[model samples]
Target: MFEYSIKENCLTNKTILVTGAGAGIGKEAAITYAKLGATVILLGKTVKKLEAVYDEIIALGLAEPAIVPLDLKGATKQNYIDMSSTIASQFGKLDGALLNASTLGELTPFTQIHEQVFSDVMQVNVNAQYLLAQALIPTLLLTEKASLVFTSSSVGSQGRAYWGPYSISKFATEGLMQVIADEYENSSLRTNAINPGATNTNMRASAFPAEDKEKLATTADIMPLYVYLMSDDSLAVNGQTIKAQ
Candidate 1:
């Protein structure tokens, strides 16, 4: 499982939607899927960043990708439903979806947590994911085999001192994954979560301001696990939380 390589056409004839695709792990995952022959839908809040990724994928002569500018913080259920409908009409089915977008609200003490801050965190991390997954389930079921990967965190499994809302949101994410996984236990769609441990992303930098970025793994280095989870080879592996190091 650790030594697998994504075949050049492993994801050929498939379509994948990746949230937070404008930067960091999301951007890298989107590009990786395109390189492995999947038509990728890049969803993010920034149009320019998504376009940059789109252009890079095109330049690589990989699959052509689509761009969806979405702000999960403000996105409504209807927006997700409409997007899902459009995807169903255009692609017929969605092969996979990476729910990678997240917000790292203020890392304050739990005692000082405010209402708006907590709501904002939960909105992007939990509420939006629930809505998006609900909308995309129909399209995912249409696929021969489909994967739904959520981005989890270390704090989700074990509470930490200063992680606050981000931590709570991740805990909710894991709970959601378990609920959805159980719901689809007998179906073709599989749901799972991954904790990209201490990677070299802006989020990491923000979370650990004093840490040395040079000591951490780059986004590219951790993609094999992401690719493996999204590929057909992992068809039997579902409903589990994995660490991508």
Candidate 2:
């Protein structure tokens, strides 16, 4: 499990947007942020899933969360613009964003990777991330200090055999984080990437169906890094990849 020294209620008054908040790490992160006092904006393709998370936060007596049901694979520039505009109008500023939505394209050899699968993976993992960040950068700048944490993978940092477009998309995600982090070096906003290695998410299950799920770290186990990256504790951390395992 990851470790970080974040103080309790460190996220009070913060407004954080979390993509793919319908399930898995994104859901856990949203709940965790709300518990720490941040108003969470849950974005995912499934409204029901987002609503379930919202109810969980409310039931916990945490800050009320907002939901944006968006499928990144089909999301457009205009879609992101509208979301950013809504956040700005509602929250006045965005303190952080967990760009955690990603898809696992088939784990096939490079030569056997399907064209549509490759495009879908890139669209969701790369294109949507770029468009969403481009739209939200202005809102992030409104904060005194802001964080943008992009989800990465072990395969992204070091290519693995038979991972196909999922690995490639993650590589692009890392590049995107570095580019944005460098460009925003002098600004109030900072960008970083986190690799949640070998977690017990559905994606991991899909990748390794035969593995014992109980042996892997759960989403709750690795949330310290997520909370740390989004909190003031990591205000000075930027343009680097942090491992959460």
Candidate 3:
């Protein structure tokens, strides 16, 4: 598992947005960030799930979390604009964002991949991220320091058979991170990518159904790096892809 010694309340007064906050790593990261003193904005497709996470945060006496039920597959660039506008009006500026939401298309042979599945996977995993970043970059610049963390996969770093469009989208994700990171190297904004290798997420279960999930690392196990990247501790780290496993 990854290790990073983050100080208590390291994210105090920070306003961070997390995509895919309804479940899995996104849910855990949202709650964890709130506990560490960052006001979390939870964006996902299901209101019920987001509300559950919201309730958990509130119950724990953590920073109040806001829920935005958004389906990334259909969200337009204007939707992201409105989201950033709302964030600016309410929080003044966004301190960080975790672009963790992604879709896993069928694990089939490269030739067997369907067009619609390919498009759907690319829309959520790559295009939505691009739109979100485009909209949030301006708000992110308003802060003295800001971080944009993209969730990557092990297959993204290296091509593998049967990974299909999901793998291709992740490769695009890594490229997106590096491009944005280089673009803002001289600015307050920082972009980085994290590969949560072998985490016991629902998505992981879907990808490797026959594998024993008991041996996989939990979301809590890899949270140190998540918190560290968003906190001031990693302000100098940019454009690099870190593996959390």
Candidate 2: regions farther than 4 A off: none
Give the winner by lDDT: 1 or 2: 2
Candidate 3 has a TM-score of 0.99
lDDT of 1 by residue, 79-104 (tens): 99999999999999999999999999
- Give a tens-digit lDDT track for model 2, residues 1-245: 66787688989999999999999999999999998999999999999999999999999998889999999988899999999999999999999999999999899989999999999999999999999999999999999999999999999988999997988999999999999999999999999999999899999999999999999999999999999999888989999999997
Candidate 2 TM-score, true structure as reference: 0.99
Q: Could you give the candidate ranking by TM-score, starting with the highest?
A: 3, 2, 1
Please list the Cα RMSD from the true structure of every candidate, rounded to 1 decimal place: 1.1, 0.7, 0.7
Q: How many steric overlaps are in each model, in order?
A: 0, 0, 0
The list of candidate 1 runs beyond 4 A from truth reads 1-3
Candidate 2's C-alpha lDDT? 0.94
Clashing pairs in 2: none
User: What value does the lDDT take at residue 160 in candidate 2?
Assistant: 92
- The global C-alpha lDDT for each of the candidates, from Candidate 1 onward, is 0.93, 0.94, 0.94
